[model samples]
Target chain A: SQTIHQWPATLVQPVGSPLSLECTVEGTSNPNLYWYRQAAGRGLQLLFYSVGIGQISSEVPQNLSASRPQDRQFILSSKKLLLSDSGFYLCAWRAAASYEQYFGPGTRLTVT
Target chain B: AQSVAQPEDQVNVAEGNPLTVKCTYSVSGNPYLFWYVQYPNRGLQFLLKYITGDNLVKGSYGFEAEFNKSQTSFHLKKPSALVSDSALYFCAVRDIRGAGAGKSTFGDGTTLTVKP
Candidate 1:
């Protein structure tokens, strides 16, 4: 079975501070990875998606960016955090031939 | 562009009654629709998907969804509501031809409250 992991489960960052959230998938290779943010437990806003290593497509322009450094490792980063950047960040992966996506536990970010 | 609409912002249902969460979509070509459930502060859980074949599809935890092509709707349904079923529900749609690298368009989400 495949498992996805993200950390730290919760984060608190100061304004203008750097941010880094990691996501790694076990037991899958060359899967499609995605980054999304949910505000106040509402709808999911897609931020970025990567189909392969070094290939990332951003959906909406914002303070955050995503990278696929390895086949199973994806990272979401920001040079500086903003108060609006605070939300629950989710990482998901889907198989090349599959329609459904599997998600990680997610990281709750609070920028103060 | 693909879009999804969940008309109800919130739904209140008593336990043991049947439940339905409505979802309608618009997209070019065939649509790949999905239903997900999210508990408080947790990641979305994939409940079911409708790709093709049967209009009725069953999913985890006694959840099912029907795909109506003419109505352009995919409504999530359950035979019996449970108190544990209280959570947020989301409907998503993506064009079938968008298989390469397309992202799914998700609805604003509907909050389902199952009271005892």
Candidate 2:
């Protein structure tokens, strides 16, 4: 069975602080990875998605960026955090040939 | 482009009663629709999906959704509601042959509350 793992399950950082959230999938290779932020526990806003290593697509202009350094490893990063960046960050992975996405536990980041 | 609409922001249902969460979608090509459930402060869980099969799709936890092509709706239904069913529900659609091929557009979620 495939499983997704994310960390720093929870984080509290001051404004302008650096941010880095990691997501890794085990038991799958060459899967598509995605990063989404859910604010107010409502709708999810797609931030970035990667089809393969070194390939990243940004859904919207934002303070965050994503990278696929390895086939099953994806990282979401920001040079400086903003107050608006506070939310639950979810990382998901879908099979390269399929449409269903599996999600990780998510990181609750709070910017103070 | 593909888009989803969960018209209701909230739904209240009594336990043991039938429950329905409405969802509608738009896409330029054949759509692949999905339903997800989210508990408080947790990641979304894939409940079920409608690919290219029978309209009525059964999923985890006694939940099912009917795909109506003419109506462009995929409404989630449960014959009997449970208090544990209270959570946020999301509808998503992916246009297989459209511009945004790999990405699925999700609707603003609906909150379902099952009362005892």
The number of the candidate with the highest DockQ is 1
Residue-level lDDT of model 1, residues B57-91, one tens digit each, is 99999999999999999999999999999999999
What TM-score would every model get versus the actual structure? 0.98, 0.98
Off by over 4 Å in 1: B98-101
DockQ scores for all the models shown? 0.88, 0.84
* Worst window of 10 by summed lDDT in candidate 2 chain A: A96-105
For candidate 1, the share of real interface contacts preserved is 0.78
lDDT of 2 by residue, B27-66 (tens): 9889999999999988999999999979999999999999
Show pairs that collide, candidate 1.
none
Q: What is the C-alpha lDDT profile of model 1 across A11-50, one tens digit per residue?
A: 9999999999999999988999999999998999989998
lDDT of each candidate versus the true structure: 0.94, 0.95
Candidate 2 has which clashing residue pairs, if any? none
Give, for candidate 1 chain A, the lowest lDDT window spanning 10 residues: A58-67
